[model samples]
Target: MTSPTTRSRTAAACMAVLLAGLAIGAAPAALAGTEDDAGLEQTVEAGEEVVTEDAVVTDGHVDVGPRFLDDEWTMLARDDREVPSVWRDPARTVLHLGDAAVLPAPDGPDYEFLGVEPGTPLHVVPQTQTPDVVWLGWNTQDPRVVDSVEQGATLRLDGLDGPGELFVFLQEGVTGPPNVLWDSGEPLPQELWMEVNTHVHANWVFTEPGIYRLDVTTLADLADGTQAEDESTLVFAVGQDTDPAQALAAVAADTTSDTASDTADEQTADGAASSDASPAADPATEVTDAPEAGAPSSDSGGSAMLVWGAALAAVVLLLVVVGRVLRARRARDAADQATGDAS
Candidate 1:
C-alpha cells in the first residue's frame, strides 16, 4: 500500500502534467485566433481607406483635376495634422518617393510646394536643392483606375498657370517645350507643348513608352527675409507606358460618371430623406393630391366665374329696386301737386 502523502503527490503530479498538456495543446489555437482577429482588424482598417470627395468651391475658381495628378497642386498649410490633400485619377496606381512627382516651379515644369501660409513667409519657396528628395507624400495616393496605359501611345499633360517653357528632364536626357522621343531620340510635335507662364494654360503630349524621369522647375515671387528670391523645382514621373492616356481618359470618365452618379444618388437620397421626413399623416386626416405642373387645376377658374356671375346678378337686382322706388315717389309727388292746384 502507498502512503497517503505519496498518493497525494502522485495525483498532484498527474494533474500538473494534464494541465501542462492542455496548455500546450491550446496555445496554437489561441495564438491563431489572436492573429486572425488582428488580421480582420487590419482588413477593416484598410477597407475603410477614406478617399476625399470632389471639393467644390463656392467662389467658382477652384482647381479641377484628379487631386493627385493635378499639376496645379497646392501644399497644405503647415501645422495641420491632416496631410496636404492630393488626388490622382488612376485610383489603383501607387506612387513612391523620388519617383516622378510634380512640384511647384518658377519656370519649366514647376511644383507649387507652398503658397501663402503663416510663419512661412508668404509665397516664399522652401529651399530644396536636392531635387530627388523633394517628394509629395503619396503613400496613400493611388490613381482612380489601375493599369490604364498601353504601349506606344502618348499622354497629354496640361499645366495650369501660363504658357512658358516646359521641360521634362530625365536621368537619361533633357526634353522640353521641344520633346525628345525616348526610343529614337527624334522629336515629335505631339510631344512638344507651348511655353506658358503662371497665368497661361499650357498642354504637352508625351507619346513614347518606357520609364522616364520628370523634373519641373519654375520661379515664383517669394519675400525671403526681405528680398524676393527663390525658385522651386517640381519633379514627378511617367512609368512604363501601358495605355497611360487611355487609362487616364478612362479614369476621368469614371470620375465624371461617379460624379454624376453621386449627384443622382444624392438627389435620390435627398428625395428619400424628404419623403421619410414628411410628417406621418393621421389615419383620420385626408390628403388631396395636387394637379400636375402648368396645367389648370380642377375647374377652379370656372367656379370663380360662377361666383362672379351670381354677385353681378345680386347687384343688378338692388339697382332696379332703387330705381323703381325713386320713380314711384316722383310720380306720386307730381299727382299731389296737380290735385292741390285744381282745388
Candidate 2:
C-alpha cells in the first residue's frame, strides 16, 4: 500500500490538473472578439430584407407586425422626447399630427431616434381627447432605447417643393405604462406602445376647424438643422376656416350650458325629494330621459346595490345584538325583584 504522504501528494496533483483544465476551457470566451461570434450584422442596401433583430423589415417594407389602435391624442417620440407634432383633434385625425404632410424631410444621412435611457423610470398615460378618440403609439422596446426618426426635423415632400416638419417614434418594444417625455419640458399623453429601434408617424386631422400652431421643441443632440432653443422648437402655420380662439370660445359656451344643466338637475332632484307638489308627470319630458329599460344603468347600480346590501346586513346584525342585550337585562331585573320579594 502507498504511504499516507505519497497518497496526499498525488491527490493534490490531480486537483491542480483539473483546475488547469477548467481555466483553459473558459479562456476562449473571455478573450473572444466580435468576429468569433456566430451570425453578425446583416446590413441592407434597399433590396429584399429579411427579419433581422426580431424586426419584420422584409422587402424594404417594415411590417409593423400588429397595428396599434389609435386614440385622440397619440404619443410619438423616443425616451423623454415626445414627437413635436401630435393630432390636434380630440379624436385621431391623420392630417394635423403627420410630420410628412407638413414638415419637409432632410436630405442628409438618415438619423435614428432613441427612447428610454437605461435604468430610467418610464411610464405612459393614455387619455381621451374627444368623446370617442383614444391615443396610441410605439414606446420602449426590448433593447430599451434605440434609434428612430426625429420630430421637428424639416422635410421636403415629393409634390410640395417647400420644406415641412418630420416627427418620428419607435417601431416596437412595449405597449403599456410609463410613457417617455421626449425632453424634460413638455409632457405628452401616457399610454403608448413601446418600440425599440423603429419609426412611426402619428396621423390625424384637426377636429375643430381652426388655425392651430404646429408646436415643436427638443433638447436632443440631434443633427444641427433640427435643433431649436438649446433643444429645438418650431411652429407651423395651421390655416382653418374657423379661428382657434373662436372655436375655443364656442367649446366654453357649450361647457357652461352643460354646467347650468347639471345645476338645474341637482335642484330638481332636491325639489322632488323635499317638495309637497308632485313631480312633473314624466321626468323624461322635464329632463334628459334615462337610458332605455334594457340598457345598462348609468349610476353603476349593480356595484352600489352590493355595497348597500352589505351595509344593511351589518346594521341588522347590530340591532339583533342590542335586542338580545335588552332581553338579558329584563331577565336580570325580574330575578332581582323575586329575590327582594323573598326577602
Candidate 3:
C-alpha cells in the first residue's frame, strides 16, 4: 500500500504536470495570431497566425495600415465572484459613443462584470520594453430584463480623448470596430452598435501612454414602446503614469486657460474623431464601411492576437490561484493526518 505521504507527493506531481500541459497547449494561441495587413496588401491565409506588435505606431499615431486583422475575444467569461463597491453601477446612465468603462477581467472575458472585482488591476500583458497594448473585457449592465427587445438594441461609441483609434469587439464580431449603421443626418455621425448585456471584449492600443476617456451612450427601444438612452463616463488609465481623475481635472483646467490655441487644436482632433475618416492619411483609414474616401472607416477582421493574450493571462492567474488552494488544502490534510496518526 502506498504511504499517505507518498500519495500526497504523487498528487502534487500530477498537479504540476497538469499545469505544464495547460501551459504548453495554450502558449501558441496566447502569443501568436494574425491581424489585417492593409498597408502590406498581404492576405493572411485563413487561420494564419499574427501578432499586434507588428502594427507599430510610429510618432504615436495610427497612420500605418492595411489595418490589423483580429477575430478574437480579448476576454471571456470566468467563474463568478461577489462585486466590490467600486465596481457596482455608479447610478449613471446615458452613455455616448467612445466612452469605455475600465473594468478588469484578469481571468476570462467577463459576463455582466462577473469575473472581476474593483481592485483586480491590470498591467499590459506580455510585459515589454515598449508596452502599448491593453486587453480589456467589459459588459454594459441593464437591470431591466428585456421581456422582448423589439428593435435589435444598438450601442454607439462616439467621442474619444487621446491618441490611437479605439477598437471594440463583440466576441464573435469582427477585428476592427464592430458593425454599425451610420447616418450623417444626426448632429454628430452615428454608429449603430449591438446592445451588450453583460460582456464585451476589446484590444486597447495606445500609441502613447496616458489617461483616456471615451464618452459612451447606449440607446434601445423596448417592447414597452419607450426609447431608452443611457450615458455615462468611462475612464481608462493607459500605463503607469495615468490617473483618470487627474486627466479629467486637467481637461477642466485647460478649458478655462488663456491658451486659445490649445483649445482649437483640441477641437480639430475631436472633429476628426467624429468623422468616419482617420486623422492620419495612412491606409488604415481606407476601410470599406461608412462614407467614401476621407470618410470615417470601420472594419472587422475578428482576429485573435489580443484575445489570446488576455485569455492566457487569465489562465495563468487562474492556475496560480488554483495551485495555492491545492497546496493549502494538502497542507491542512497532512496536518490532520499527522494528528490522527499520533492519536
Candidate 4:
C-alpha cells in the first residue's frame, strides 16, 4: 500500500509542476501589456516640449499642426525628423521637397480632380510614408491643446501662393477611395474640421516645382467657454533647386487674388454683363467634412495582432498542461487503488 508520506510528496510534486507551467504560459501576455503601456507613455512625454530654433526638414516625419502655448492658440510644426520630437514655430521651419518626391501622376478619372495631365510628373508627399521623402502630416495631439479645446478645431486654407497648384487628399485604406481636403483650384478659405487629439496624414500633391506658401489658420472653442484663433504661414521649398531662404522670406499670399481672378474671367466672357460680382462661395466651407480622425498608425494593427496571437498561444499551452496533469492524476489514483486491493 502507498504510505501517507509518499502520497503527500506526490501531491506536492504535482502542484509545483502545474504552477511552473502556468507561469510559462502567462509570461508572454504579461510582457505584451508592459510594452504597450511603455509605448503610450513615450508618446506623451515626447510632445511635452516646444523647440524654438529654426529648422529645415527634408526627410523623416514632421507634423504641421496647432497647439496652445501659455493659454494662447498657435500654429506650429512638430518635427520628428529626429528623436524626441518637439514643436517648432511654423514661420521658422522649412519643409524641403526633394527630387525623391517626384512621381508620375496616376491614370484614373478619380485623380483628374488634381487638374494634372495623367502620366505627367507630380511632386507628392504621400499619406503613407516613403523612406527618402519627408512624411508630413498634421495633428491636434498636444497635451495642452487637448486640455484646452472643446471638441475640435477648424483648419482653414486662407491663401496659397506657389508656382503650381497644391492639392491635399486622404485615402481611407491601402485600396480605399481618395478624399480631397483642399484644392488650390478651388476658392480660398476652405476649411477642414479636425477633432481634438487627432493625428492625420494626407497626400500633398504639387503640380510643379517651386517655392510655395500656405496661409493656415486654426479656430476652436475653448473649454473655458471662450474662442481661440490663430493664423500662420507654412512655407515649402518644392524642389532640389528651390531655395529654402526664398520660402522663409515669403509673405502671406494676397487672399483677394482668387476674387480678382474670377472678376477677370467674367470680363473676358463673350456677351456677359460687366456688373461686379462677388467671388464664388467655397462649397467646402458649408459642409466641412472631417477626415478620419485618430486612424490607427501603421504599427498599431500589427501590434494588436501580435498581442492576440501571444494570448492565444498561452491559452493553448495552458490547456495542454491541464490535460496532462489530469491524466497523470487519474493514473496515480488507479495505481494506488490496485496496491490497496493487493494489500
Candidate 5:
C-alpha cells in the first residue's frame, strides 16, 4: 500500500514530466511560426519595385541583358556610358540607329548567310565597337544573375515586327563563317544560349531602315533547383531619319493573332478534312508560375539557435525541479525514521 507521502511524490513527478514534455513540444511550434514570419517578410521585400526612368541611346556603349532585380528576373539595358552605370527598363528605352551605323554588306561567300547581296546597303550595328555608333551587346555578368544561375541562360526571340529583315550574328575570326544566332528569314522563336558571367557582342543587321520591335525573353535554371524567366520588348529605330519616339511608342506584335492566322492558313492548305485534328500547343504562349529567386536559406540558423536555447532552458528547469523534489523526499523520509525511533 502506498503511503500519503509516496502518493504526493508520484503526482509531483508525473506533473514535472508532463510540463517538460509540453515545453519541448512548444519550442518546435514556436520556431516554425518564427520561420514562417521571416519568409513572409522576405516575400514582401521581393515584391517592392525599383524606380527607373526613360532613356534613349543613339551612341555610346550599352548592354541589353537579364538581371535579378528585387529577386525577380528582369530585362533591362545597362547604359555603360553613365558615370555610375544606370539600368533602364527596355520598355521605356529606345536604341536609335544613326547615319554612322550604315554600311555596305561585306563582299565574300562568308557573308552570304546575311541574305544580302554584296555591297548592299545595310544598317549594321557592328560586332566591333564604332565610337560614333551605339555599341550594343549583351552580358550575364550581373552579380545576382551570376550567383543564382546554374551555368547559363537561354535568350529567345519570340517575335519580330519590322519593315525589313533582321540578323544577329557573331563573327569570331576574320576568315571563318559567321555564327548566326537569330535570323528573321529563317523562322520565329529562335533560341540563343549564353554562358554565365560572359559578355558578347554581335552584328545586328537590318535590311532596310524602319522602326523594329523585338519580343525577347530570357530563361534560366537557377542554382536553387528552380527556374527564372522574363519577357520584354526591345525597340529600335534603324535609320537616321527614323524617329526614336515612334520606336518607343511601338507595341509588341500580338503573337496569339499571328498563331491563329498561321493555323487557319495551314488548315486552308490542308483542306477541310484536316480541320478535325487538334492544333498543336504554342510554346511561346505557355505561362508558368515561378517563385521569386530568394536569398539563400541561411536565415534558418537564427531560428535553430532559438530552438536550442529554449530546449536548454527547459532541460535546466526540469533538472532543478526534480532535484528539489528528490531532496524534499529524502528530508521527509529522514524525519519519519527519526520519529519512529523515538516512539
Candidate 6:
C-alpha cells in the first residue's frame, strides 16, 4: 500500500509538471514580433508572409484575424535616420487635399512613368504641378506642410473612413505598407507609412471611391535636436463629384442606406461589361469598375491548428511527466517496503 506521503509527493510533482507545460504552451500566442501581432493572440511561425496572416477559417467558420489599421486615427512615429537625397527626385506633380481621381495603373512596374496597380494614396491628392502619374493632382494646390518643405519631411498617412482597403507600396526604391487597411482591429506590420519627401513615388490603391478624408502627418528630425511636425487633412473626391463635403455625404448616405453594399453588387453584376469598358478618355474622369481582388478571408485553420497542437502537446507532456513520476514513485515505494521487510 502507498503511504499518504508518497501519494502527496506524486500529486505535487504532476501538478508542477502540468503547470510548466501550460506556461510554455501559452507564451508564443501572447508574445508578438511584428506590429501585425500587436493586437492578435496570433503566433506567427517562421516563413509566413505578412499579408497572408489574415482571418482564417478553422472548421467552416471564419476565425478572426489581424488588421492593418485601427478604425480610428492611430498615431505612428517614423524614426528612420536616413533621409532621401531629393524629396521629389524625378519631380512628380504635387497633390492637394480635396483632390479626387480614378487612380491609373498599367498593371506593370516602372511606376514613375509606368502605372502600377492602382493602390497608391498619393495619386488622388491635389498637387503643385499636374502629376504625370495621377491626373487629379494637376490643377490642385500642394497640401504639404510649408516649414518642412526645404529641410525634407517623412510623409505618413493618418486616419481612415469609408469602405474597402487602402494599399500603398513601393517596389524597388522603397518599402511601405502593402497589406489591406481595414477598420477591423488587426495587427499591422508597420502601422506608420514610410518617410518620404516630395521626391518619393509610391503605389496607392483604394478599393472603393468616394470622398476620403485622411490626415497626413509629416515629421522631420533635424540635426539640432528639433522635431519638425506638420499635419493636415487630405480629402479625396472619387467617382462622381469633386466636392469633398458632397462626396462625403454621398458615401455616408450610401453606407447609411446600405448603398455601399448596393454599389458593390452593381459592380459585380457588370464586371464583364465593365472589364471591356474602355479606359477613361480623360483619365481625370472618375472611372467605376470592379475593384481588384485582395487577400480573401480564409480559415484561420493554420493558427487554430498551431494553437490546438500546442495544447495537445502540452497535455501529452503533462501525462508523460505524470506517468514517469508515478512509475518512479512506485519503484521507490516498493524498494522502501522491501528494505523494511528485510530488516
TM-score, per-candidate, Cα-based: 0.29, 0.20, 0.32, 0.60, 0.59, 0.28
Clashing pairs in 4: none
Instruction: Write model 2 residue lDDT over 1-343, tens digit each, in one string.
Output: 4443544444334322212222111122223235422111122121122211111000111111111122111122221112222112221111122221221111111111212222221111111111112222222221211222232222111111112222222212122111222321223322233233332223122222232333322122223343222111111122322333443344346558978999999999998877766555665566656888788785778888989999999999999999999999999999999999998
> Which stretches of model 3 miss by more than 4 angstroms?
1-135, 138-143, 170-192, 195-198, 248-343
Error of 6 at 291 (Å): 71
Q: Of models 2 and 3, which has the larger TM-score?
A: 3
1-343 in candidate 1: lDDT tens per residue?
Answer: 4433544444334322212222111122124234322211110011112343322111111111111123332211011112443332223222222222222222122212212111211111011111332212111111211112111111223221111232332111111122122211223222321111101111111222222222222122222222111111122123223333443344446558979999999999999999999998787886767988987777887898999999999999999999999999999999999999999
lDDT score of model 4? 0.71
lDDT of 4 by residue, 1-343 (tens): 3442544444334322212222211122214235322211224342467987767778887877777677678888887756667778886788888998877665445667877655567787866566688877777777787788899888899999889999987654433446788998998989887777766666788988898888899899999999999988787889889988777665323335656787888767732553335456588776644546797755788999999999999999999999999999999999999999999
lDDT of each: 0.29, 0.29, 0.36, 0.71, 0.71, 0.35
TM-score of 5: 0.59
Better of 1 and 5 by lDDT: 5
Which residue window of length 10 is worst by lDDT in model 1?
58-67
- What does candidate 3's lDDT look like per residue over 1-343, in tens digits? 4433544444334322212222111122223233421111111122222222111111111100011124211111111111210122211111111212222322212321222232333232111111233222333232232233454455455666654334332222212122223222234434544433322332332333565555556555667786665553344455544554565464455446736878888999999878857465658667544567764334322345667788999999999999999999999999999999999
For model 2 the local lDDT of residue 235 reads: 17
Could you give candidate 5's per-residue lDDT for residues 217-262 as a string of tens digits?
9999999999899998888999999988767655423445667899
lDDT of 5: 0.71
Worst 10 residues of 5 by lDDT: 39-48
User: Measured by C-alpha RMSD in angstroms, how accurate is candidate 5?
Assistant: 39.0
Clashes of each: 47, 57, 47, 0, 0, 30
- Model 6 residue 53 CA deviation in Å: 44
RMSD of each: 28.6, 28.1, 40.3, 39.3, 39.0, 37.7
Q: What's model 3's TM-score?
A: 0.32
Q: 130, model 5: CA deviation in Å?
A: 0.3
